[model samples]
Target chain A: MATTKTPSRLVLNGLLNENPIFRLALSMCPAVGISTTVMNGLMLGTAVLFVQVCSSCTIAAIKNYIHPRIRIPTYTLTIATWVTVIDLVLSAYAPEAYKAMGIFIKLIVAFAIITMRLEVFACKNTVAMSFWDGLGMGLGFMFGMVTLGFIRELLGMGTLLGHNVLGFRPLLFFALPLAGFFCVGFMMAIFNYVELVFNRRKKRRG
Target chain B: MARLRRITYLTLGFLLLAYLLVFSGCAGSQNRFIKKTSFRGTHSILITFAGPVDEEWATKASNYRVYEKPDPDIVLKISTIELSTNRQTVILHFEEPLNQNQPHMVTMRGIMTEGKSVGTAIVKVRKLYLGYLFSILIGAMLVQNFVFTKYLGLCVFFGTSQKRSTAVGMGVTFTIVIVASAMMSWFLYQFFLKPFHLDFLQIIVFIGLVSLSVQAVDTILRKVNPMLFKAFGVYLVLVIANCIILAVPLILADNEYNAAESLMLALGAGLGFLIALFLMSSVRERLELANVPPTYRGLPIAFVVAGLFALAFLGFSGMSIF
Candidate 1:
């Protein structure tokens, strides 16, 4: 295999091509759970970003030494360590978010994306590269989560981050998990459309 | 040699990390542990009746310091007993006291049990464990159900129900994921989240763990049996981010359930999810040939059907089988 250095591609793949919520569709627990409000989604996204990036970096650094037989347990141990630290800090300081997030926060330890990065990307890449990749993927997931949150919060409650943007009767169903299905469907359609447009324009220019 | 070195290094690294995590986690919370003794607070209730106290029953109850007064001014007695159903009723008895115009204080307590007790004697009342289990089973199946109330885990519920054969496979796949995820979450919460004081990180941790486990399983399945992976690939991936698997542990942790109860809950929830999926998929297959409106074809009609199911399930809320 030839060695390749392509940082931007890694970031782009995560942001759009393999977006966590839309494309790869990993990490939907908090995406659906907290997308009730823009602020809830934003804070949750940030927390996930921090954990994902940190865990990816550590996993990359130790990838070579991790045996195939025990790679999972090792990754879990590391992820658990970071999650515990974050959990403690949150309960002590931000108790409200902790309560609101409830088990979804704890559930993150089992999220497929963190392990997928370890097995697929971090295992092969340098630590620095892994960090960037993690950041991009984490942020991509956050973007989808927050966008879903914004739409649901705005339509369901006539507000954005609790601030009233328009005076209209709320579509209460938009706040529910079923709404997540509708939101993801529409978002994926838009993503598909944008990609189609961008490709067609590029082809014309070429 | 390379494999051995990797295994040894990885093992050491994991052990060291776990130790550091536990140590730092406990250190952060100086007032974490609180000791409790057995004899903290003990008390017994006494009941007085208008008639002579039942000697044999009173004698047995005296061990617990519980007693009966034959000439008491006030008391509560067991009025009705339904042993088969574990239901009982008590009546209050009050009489004019000897203080002429003053009212007297009397207390009567009924101790009910299924098995013979070393303490006070009373009518037999079947244990609540069975009752609790019945309620839990019913609750898991219908009321506060995985499908209707929580709205969790609809992805697999809908995705797996397209064909009967696919539904069975999906159900089995879901059950496995549920059991594995629940056990994993339970252990992680008890050992890591609680002890280490890293509770704030629960959402990320749970999601991360489930995601990783699913990924690992997918990898192993793909490598070992390409045919099996091909058959269940899409549905298996859907199960990874399923809300039910993640949500059950949250509910379990919130309720402060024991290990047994958590496992029961996981099983009940997995079964509940399977039930919903089977029902919806069968209906969809029939709907495929029906003359349907163009606008309300796929998802919208399914939502309406699900809403009706939810409404039907609401009838089971007040039922108490135990």
Candidate 2:
């Protein structure tokens, strides 16, 4: 795996094969909680991206310095610092998004994505490679959240980013919790379908 | 010695941080963000009831004004008379006073009846912050219940409902964690985020706090009560990811609850969550043995069961118990 070091594969894998929400299905808290709006999805995805990349780099760079027993603590501290920085900035500048996204932003500390990457990629890879992996994973999360938000917003309110894209009629139930389940389930199905197609195409070519 | 020292240092750090938070008034709303609504001329007595009732009753009681458009100014003397299967009781308390003689409509939301069946009570609120807290709790917890309203966290609802004992235990456990974690998270947000201008880290902080707290609880449980720890070890770990825990703090922070109000809301929300989970779990436990299923073995069938239970919960939203 280390010898392969394929950036394109890393990027593609993060988006699809190893997608944070769809494939791995970790971090459902934020996925379900914040997918009410596209802007929320975007902001949270960006924040997670920042934390994921920075923490991945730190973990890779300090792979040797960290004691096996204390690796979790060190990773936590590193992640916490970055989270603190992001939380402060969001509250100061984008108070609404901060408020809307709420505890999910702070939840980045325990998000399985960061720790998973550390255990899987960052621990074994170079700092630069870890950064790219983080980016790929972050983008994957962004894709999942944005898609969930889009489906939810569209069906729930007949709007995208608070705009009336689908005209005057809106499905009231779409804004309800059931709508969230429907949207997420629908996206997961779509993800599986796309994965199936992509895999089939790859098999045929090979 | 090293482990003890580390524990001491971390505990002290959290306590000091908490002290600074309280000193700075960052733990909550600091009694700010109170907005008054237009009041009606009549003395809008906010009458709440037990469980879910007909909307027609509420509309008739408040003369339909409360149902149509909420008037902001009338001082609402809120009370409830709950009639349950066990007995009938009335519980009363004081809310913030309203601007006198202002035209306002009273709406009945659910309130804690203190384990009583039928209860009647009146509450008056004068402070804007208390009013804000009161309204938000009503809106978020009862009116639009996270369990009933948003229908979030149903996964745990089904997951923990295998037995009556586990259901009750999980319900109580969830309540404790929810109340404690919500308060802590609110404090962290108020003190850490606002003053230091580190509010952007709210999610990371909250997640960190929850994960650490859950892990700490797991460690302490293992050491102190190994039997109890072994019983619900897996459940305890799973609670870390429970969306209810995460959602509550987010709601509290967004609402800007003061310490006292935040605590109350947490208690209420936790109770509400427990109520929902325990009820569903009990029902699901009974349904476990008797089932006709070929395709719908696990999650899919659980979803359908949950949808039915969710429908039942929706009935309670109309309860005039506030």
Candidate 3:
């Protein structure tokens, strides 16, 4: 974290290397609960993105002033404050999405990734680094959700987004909570395998 | 030293001031009529009342008016109305299938259930008695297991569940915290948040409450028994961040559950999580000897196992436990 990398690199790091769901596996509840469809995933991801970036920046700005003993509570409050803002905004502007996401939005206050970024990177790093990191991590989570959502929606319901594509449900099982577990499991394996191959190829080229 | 203390105090005071301001601003917030609404199928709406209504009044199709929430211009016609065996639940069937995604409104002349006599009210829905409470507990534990069905708390579900002993220990500790925090959350929501229309601050308040409970448990465990401390110390911290712990309170608040109902739900959720952990850990311990793929060595394989368990547990959904 202290080595001082570029913003794009940090973002990519969040997307690939430190992907919150697939890589670090910090907050898996929302990943499974909200990823029943691409739209649901995208909505939750966007909300998370806003909350993450805002909380990250706020913590980075106020890091020095917060007493260490009270830092955890302060972080929770910061995350909660951001969550409340987004929760209200969504309920007002997009009541549909708000109803769909439900308690998951409020539960975001307890999400480890937001606070993890603050305690690990934002508290020690510059505001710019925290921003990029937050953006990357948020996007990474969104990527995971959309991917899982796509797989579930496409196969589970024979639909893309909300429209029917296959015209027949191929594996309706994928739509169930049971399949959510398998989809994430397989996706993780794919990510790990690709990373392994990528590492080997780079080593050979060098 | 004085300046640092002053800054901390100032920060704390600032948060309080902001909270009070929001409270005063929303002082006009009036409590909504307590009603709970749930759709059984696309065509059926089940509305539960706190008390039994006059059978004739509640069962009359003419007594209820339904409309699709977004497009309120068109009133959907009710085909038939039936009361439950217990007389606490009213079932209405519509000519057209109700849209699950769209929120619907039901205006009844008088419930004769929730303290209203003659005024028409927009019904939301809510509960019943001992048999009902038992169903809620079982529904949460088995039929609607939070981990397998609702997909909450997968982080802790997969993390500590590597070993059977640890999983069970974590389950007990989690149940303790969840029950304790759930009661506290219920009390706070009923007394503080509901009346002031400070519902927006729920996330922050609940998180603070959860973390505080976790901290208390951590301290007490450390003092009481070193053996217990070694087992539950790590999970006690992680429990604060677990989704199930936070989810129970939100659900109770949404359902407008009473103290008894909330307690049952919290207990059910905690026990459900414990059961899930126990089952997963048992399988996971056995998986240690099995050959899992290199890429799917640890978590990936565990997830697959969880998927299978979820499938198995899903069979209970058909049971008429009540």
Question: Could you tell me the TM-score of candidate 3?
Answer: 0.76
**Residue A54 error, candidate 3, Å:** 0.6
The sequence of per-residue lDDT tens digits that candidate 1 reaches over residues B78-102 is: 2221121112222221122122111
DockQ of every candidate structure: 0.11, 0.16, 0.64
**Model 3 Cα displacement at B173 (Å)?**
0.8
lDDT of 1 by residue, A129-150 (tens): 9988998888888888889998
TM-score of chain B of each: 0.61, 0.58, 0.63
- Using DockQ, give the best candidate's number: 3
Q: Which ranges of candidate 2 are over 4 A from the true structure?
A: A1-5, A92-103, A106-110, A157-165, A168-170, A189-206, B1-144, B147-169, B181-212, B243-260, B279-320
Tens-digit lDDT track of model 3 for B151-260: 89988888899998788778877877897898899999999999999887788888889989988988877876567678768778789778899899889888887766
Per-model TM against the reference: 0.63, 0.62, 0.76
Over B1-322, each residue of candidate 2 has an lDDT whose tens digit, in order, gives 3433443454445445444534554232211111123332233332333344333333222322222223444434444322324322222222444443222333333323343322222233222343444554555566666665565555465567667667666666666667668878988889888789875556567766777777777788689657656667888866754667766777777767677567656656766666667766666666677673533444434445555655566676655322
What fraction of the genuine interface contacts, i.e. the true contacts, does candidate 2 reproduce? 0.14
Q: Give the CAPRI class of candidate 3.
A: medium
TM-score of chain A of each: 0.89, 0.90, 0.94
* Cand 3, B chain, TM: 0.63
The runs of at least 3 residues in candidate 1 whose Cα sits more than 4 Å from the true structure, single-residue gaps closed, are A1-9, A196-206, B1-89, B92-128, B147-163, B176-250, B258-260, B280-322
